[model samples]
Target: MWSRSDAPRIMIVRLSAIGDSILTLPVLNALRDHFPHARLSWLIADYCAPIVRGHESLDELVEVNRGWLKSPRTIKQVRRRLHDMRLDVTIDVQGLAKSALPAWLSGAKRRIGFSRADREGREFSTWLNNELVHPSALHVVDRNLGLLKPLGIDNPTVRFDVPEHPSEIKAASDFIESRTLRQGFVVLNINAAWLSKRWTMERFAQVAKYLADRYGLASVLPWGNEREREDAERVAAKVPSHAMVLPKFSLTQLGSLFRRARLFVGSDTGPLHLASAVGTRCIGLYGRAVDRSGVYGPQGIVICHNHTSSDDAMRRNKDNDAMRLISVDEVCQAC
Candidate 1:
């Protein structure tokens, strides 16, 4: 294992989940700041690989197909790829068994990972690593950055620069043109991965309509999975005639679309975080979750609530205790 004195080829292993991957960019930047000329590569999931494809700080991006972990041929291919890369230091930022295998197989002299107490997963992943990054009372973004401390890198100002795809820029421009939207527009992303976290479709529709009537702002909705699309459609049905429901877009395309938006309002989801990363004003709806560690607002107003247990049972009660308590008036005031 290379000591702190030696600058070695490094690989950062942070796989899937778009929001989490976006948060890792600061860590990548810190590593570059510490080792300006060191060979640095990122092992990212195929789904989010496009977001960091042309990152200036990275030497190379190694794609890891999470689906392939279950297949022997895919594992063999990944193993061969790691063998060819000859990484000197492997850091497992995902802290999951799935992320650990790549680090173990990378044949790096120094394998670093979160300790068992800090991370939840198969314990063996930590056993395989040569070093452990102990847990501290830090944000996930800072924790990811802390992993670089072993390599002599310290806390650095977070900066995420996602490139704009030419095609996506054209598409967003065409979308605005098709709608005859001349002024600034607001992009409202209403869908989230968890059902517990999402507000009612009717509620989102009401918000969209309110924006159109009061703000005179054009609104667009972006959906990820099929269920999210259905939710968007439901919201679109109730929106003003001018508000549009946009089609699915790649991560890069989404970044481009977000950059052009005047405001972003969404559930605790990836695209919301992406918008926040780009310094867009955001109003995030968080339920049954902590906003401090995650779902934080980005240099803008944020309204967070924890849904009461009554809200969880589908009882249709308006308790207004936690997240459900966040009123439409509060959200509009932020916007």
Candidate 2:
């Protein structure tokens, strides 16, 4: 437990995944609000740091390359950097060995982390963190907020102050203007990081056609890789006049784009959560039951019907059978 220092030094550790990192924004902002004079830092990997890079509440952005814990040189640098910061508290929001390493290395007394059940690394991260929190909240976002209980903040006003750079905002504006999406368009993120979460491109095309015909809204499909691009092209082929396949967009540009979007249709990926964070209505198609991990806000409409809710192990499986269960008519009805 922190001894109630006025200018407490804190470092929040959530190292990977665009979706989880976006969800952690509310934690950052709430911490900043409560401890106004505190020097707040976030430990994140370089790959996903772009998502929360320029957040107003963050005092420092401690970045590490992938697999930094294995590299002696990188470990030394991180140790030195964190040692200099003199973090009073370390919050391991990401409950894994890799995320726990920073807290263990930081030398902070109050290394807050989730309980054994919530955490993936029961043997490693559990012992590294001294302050244990057993989260009772249903949603992952609220479960994260529950960690703030040890800090005297309960029921904090949830906020995701997703930073939008001027250049990226301008770029998003230019693209929307050029595409003539001012009349209103729906962002169709047809790709999912996990294969199990992905729906068929043909089904996606049907939803795109419905949006165009029923609401007169265009569909913009964004892709991350070549395979996804090819899949997007196939979806676009069906609704040529209504759907437009977008070229590669940077993470920041996508954030800006979601802010101007009317609705977002995708699986439970980063883009869906990002769109939801930016106040865009999202129709999130889930492979598992609609549990706490579904889109955070009321604006999100999730479509899912599984025997049980999803966990980390279930989410990583190589089966699209659950995804196939979601019909195009279900998505169209949600639209």
Candidate 3:
């Protein structure tokens, strides 16, 4: 962050959620490029740590669970660790009250964060960061990179160093052989963290059939929980010739599988971003969220049906009629 000879201690504070965690990888890559000698670290949530766990760019990965601040013992432990790091700067990429508190706790002289114009960077975060950046880009990845202008870095090369472990590779290969999916397949991630973002099974079935008949690509459905598992099975049962379901696996393993798939068709969810990060062909389905949060690269094809909905109206936790607007014919044509 200073002289070429100096190796500044920098930490990135991104609290939680899967998709956002994947998007932050580009910022980490940029920072590493700018300061080759810098000791770079990331403060991530426990759930999302695996996404960036073994990245070549990161020197440290400090993971904490939700509501850790509420516990006096946990706070003491985290603060002690932050103090020992002797951080030169802490960037608040999360831009929330929870994310802001970590930056304040870091006690870094050059605490950088986004301006209030960014919806996420409101009054609470503004009070914490010592330096504020007014981002010019619309995409979240570009916006995160905009924070690096203070360090004399601009328009840095966009890259995601998603780890491909040996064990995960073997697991993915074994699954592929077991399922007889050697003829190449496309991932249909029908489940989403937001109900509003999830397209109907019938629509997914139609897309699955089209992929099978038109492209000779079978559909692979991956689920997170038991409820999703049942839904995936139901879809597979209906489209037995075209669709199949993947068993329980970790995020890392899923990345390995996605790397081998012909295409990824999913809503604005973690799996879609993960697929994008691993350099897979992604057809991102958007409704509640904007296309700006779509897949990161040229290989991505965004099918957005959102017309008049506002960000405040399409909350992730609530169900909306927006996703239904994305018809089967539209997805088939995109395919």
Candidate 4:
């Protein structure tokens, strides 16, 4: 029912989680392609905004601090800001009470979201949207794109237009130059946000050592926080000859690193998704998400323990038996 002559003020709402935010990039791409003349805005968390801050396809960004919901005063501030935007259409790809509440408050004429059966917090959020879409069994990227059907967008392409910051690229270049790292060095990320998803430090060392000895490749370990830095240091200590632990970097700097790397080896996490988006070949280790099926891009491969059952894969803990069952040789061979 929408026409090319109409220019609706559009707002997309997908907030938090590094990986999920990156996956929502395709939805932005589709809307940009179809409604080039419209004013398109993204309501994202403050932390993940840098990933797409300078993207060419985006018109505006609304950053919501993580703790804003805790204070009534701040909540009113956010509500007032969103209401002032006068959005004609609002798409809630996040599909939660937190996201739904804001979408509802925006007072958009065409509010779209996943159906009650397809989305979580169904009982709480079912009434927030004027239009509901029943999604198919597809990758989260495509599932997010499905929300565009009501706006007359279909069969959209998967594209990640992650912007490059010149300063960040210079930092990445300087780091590589200082280390004397050659082209085609592998990036090994040792931490996952979830405890059940991390492969052991010893196994990571073994893989790094093997890559060094067999393929003459150096391995760099990039950590996000103090705990990850400690783990990366332990791994680097074992293979001191070929492994280097990187200092903490911003999101854009990590993207710069991934763009220069020959390949990426990591658990199912935000960095792995970032690597795939930047056109790096990736070997993702899996436990509960073993059959990551369509989640990866063309050059990305997933390795998992053959014996793990589907129902038992996603348990939460520091030491996952299924993840531990995967051998270093399996990961090395896949790389």
Better of 1 and 2 by lDDT: 2
lDDT score, candidate 1, position 179: 77
Tens digits of per-residue lDDT for model 2, 1-335:
34335789999999988889999999998898888888999999998999888899999999998889889998999999899999889999998888888898988888998888743336588889988888788888998998889898889989998999999999988999999889999999999878888999888888898999999999999998899899899999988998999878998899999888889999988888889998899999988855767988889998887636667677787688888988998889888
Candidate 3 residue pairs that clash? none
Q: lDDT tens digits, residues 211-289, model 4?
A: 9998889999999889999999999999999899998899889999999998899987889889988889999887764
Q: What residue runs in model 3 are displaced by over 4 Å at the alpha carbon? A: 312-314
Candidate 1: segments with Cα more than 4 A from true spot: 1-7, 118-122, 291-298, 307-323
Query: Please, what are the lDDT tens digits per residue for candidate 1 over residues 222-283?
Result: 88789878877877878757367888777788888788888899866788878988778888
| lDDT of all predictions | 0.76, 0.88, 0.88, 0.83
lDDT of 3 by residue, 1-335 (tens): 48656799999999778999999999899988888899999998899999999899999999999879899899889988998899999999888778888888987889899888847586599899989999678788998899999988899999998998999999999999998889899999999867778889988988899999999889999999999999999999889999998989899999999999999999888999999999999998887557358678899998876644356434755674788888898888877
Candidate 2 has which clashing residue pairs, if any?
Answer: none
Off by over 4 Å in 4: 118-123, 290-295, 306-314, 317-319
TM-score of model number 3: 0.96
* TM-score (C-alpha) between model 2 and the true structure: 0.96
TM-scores of the candidates are: 0.88, 0.96, 0.96, 0.94
